[model samples]
Target: MLQIKDLQARVEDKEILKGINLEIKPGEVHAIMGPNGSGKSTLASVLAGHPGFEVTGGQVLFEGQDLLDLKPEERAREGLFLAFQYPVEIPGVSNMTFLKTALEEIRAHNGLPAFSAKEFMKLLREKQDLVEFNTSLVNRSVNEGFSGGEKKRNEILQLAMLNPKLAILDETDSGLDIDALRIVAGGVNKLRSSENAFLVITHYQRLLDYIVPDVVHILSGGKIIKSGPKELALELEEKGYDWLREVETTE
Candidate 1:
């Protein structure tokens, strides 16, 4: 559902993503693993149309549309979801209110009717249960005073409610206890289906133990240097990223 070809991007004068080529089809989960400053998150940010980064070269197509041409909100309305590495807090906006407005806007963009009050509540309940989100937090401000785990789960909750065709999870497992990690992963697993795809960016192999990506890619020097099956993550866990330097040199 998404295709990226020789995608290059830069922040100010320094280039980050250099010729990143990837394609994610529906029903597939792709994991990108890299060390610090490898531009893994930059790819996610670029895909989500972050204004800070400028697209210098190549193309990105989302469901055959030129993704780069759309504004960030337009991209979201088009079924592209980016779960931030650090989910920001909106002090005055309640979580429920934020999600309701987002969902309604997306639906309206696609010419769908807004959910009735009862219907909205029912849908909210289902998604909250799916993500194992704290119902009590629903009435609280978005990510305001939330723990790291709570913030991540809230991201998953938003993902569930939006039901985007392509979800880009940028370091969702960055901070969590094992139990919280399992809950978050479980929610993601349950949400997987033939109609949607996921691009997961993480640093550890442990995250892959639960999400079980269909493909694992090694990104370095702002380029995808290696891609293999899920077992690649295990190899990376054991061999470390240093060995990939040889791979990059050869390429």
Candidate 2:
């Protein structure tokens, strides 16, 4: 569903992603593992059209449309979702109101009719059940006063509600305990189908144990250096990113 070619991006003249080339097809889950400063999150931000980073070169096509040409909101309307490593707290906006506004905007973008309040509440309840999200949290301000795990679960709840075509989870496992990780991963697994894809960016293999990827890619020096099956994550866990660095140097 997403194709990236020779993707290069920079922030304030400091280059982050040098040349990234990757493709994620529907029904496939791809995991990107890399060391610090390896540009894993940069890829996610660029795909989400974060204005802080500027694309220096290359092209990204999402289902044949020029993704780089779209604004961040446009990207979201186009069915691209990015789960941030740190979910920000909006103290005044209740989670329910935020989600309702977001869903309405997306529906309007797709030329679909708006959901009635009753219909929206039913849909929200169903998705909350799907994610095992706490209904009490929905009535409160978004992410405000929530624990780290609760924040991550809220992100998954948003993902479940959006039903994006391609979900890019950037360090979703960060700060999450084992139980929270399982809950978040379970929600993601339930949402997986033949028509959607996932790009999971993580620094460790522990997350992969729950969300088994179809392919594991080693992203280093702002590029994907190697791609392999799920077992590759086990190998990386056993051996480390140094081996991949050595391989890159040799090549």
Candidate 3:
């Protein structure tokens, strides 16, 4: 569903991603594991069309369309979702209102009519049940007073509502305890289907225990250095990333 070729991006004259070439097809779950400053989040941000980063070279095609050419909102409307490592809080905007506006916007993009209030409430309840999201949280402002796990769950709830073609979860496991991790991962796993794909970016293997990626990639020095099966995550957990770094330097 997504193809990236030699993707290079920079922020404020400092390049982060260097020649990132990867393809994620429908029904596949790919995990990207890397050390600090390895450009994992940068890849996610660039793919999501975050304005803070500028693409210097290479091309990204989403279902044969030029993804880099689209604006961030355009990317979202095109069915690309990025679950941030830190979900921002909008104190005045209730979660329900935020989700309704986003969902309607997406529907409008797809040439569908907006949902009526009753239809929206029904849809919200269904998605909440799908993610096991607390109804009370929906009444509050987005992530305003939520705990770390709650914020992550809220992201998953958004994911369920949007039903994006490709979901890029940037360190969704960060700051989550074991239970919260399981809840978030479970929600993601439940949403997996043959028509959608996932790009899971994480540093540790614990999250993989729940999500079980179809492929695991080792990213280092601003590029993906190794790609392997799910067992690769176990190997990385056992051996760590130093061995990969050494191999990269020597090669």
Candidate 1 deviant stretches above 4 angstroms: none
Query: On a 0 to 100 scale, what is the lDDT of residue 221 in model 1?
Result: 91
Give the C-alpha lDDT of model 1: 0.96
**Compared to the true structure, candidate 1 yields what TM-score?**
0.99
Residues 121-236 of candidate 3 have per-residue lDDT tens digits of 99889889866789999999999999998999999999999999999999999999898898899889999999999999999999999999999999998999999999999998
Ranking by lDDT: 1, 2, 3
All models: lDDT? 0.96, 0.94, 0.94
Give the Å error, residue 187, model 1: 0.5
TM-score of every model versus the real structure: 0.99, 0.98, 0.98
The total number of steric clashes, by the backbone 3 Å criterion, in model 2 comes to 0
lDDT of 3 at 240: 82
Tell me how many residue pairs clash in candidate 3.
0
Instruction: Rank the models by TM-score, top first.
Output: 1, 2, 3
TM-score, candidate 3, is 0.98
Model 3, stretches more than 4 Å misplaced?
Answer: none
Which model, 1 or 3, shows the larger TM-score? Answer: 1
- What lDDT tens digits, residue by residue, belong to model 2 across residues 27-127? 99999999989999999999999989999999999999999999999999999999999999999999999999999999999999999999999999999
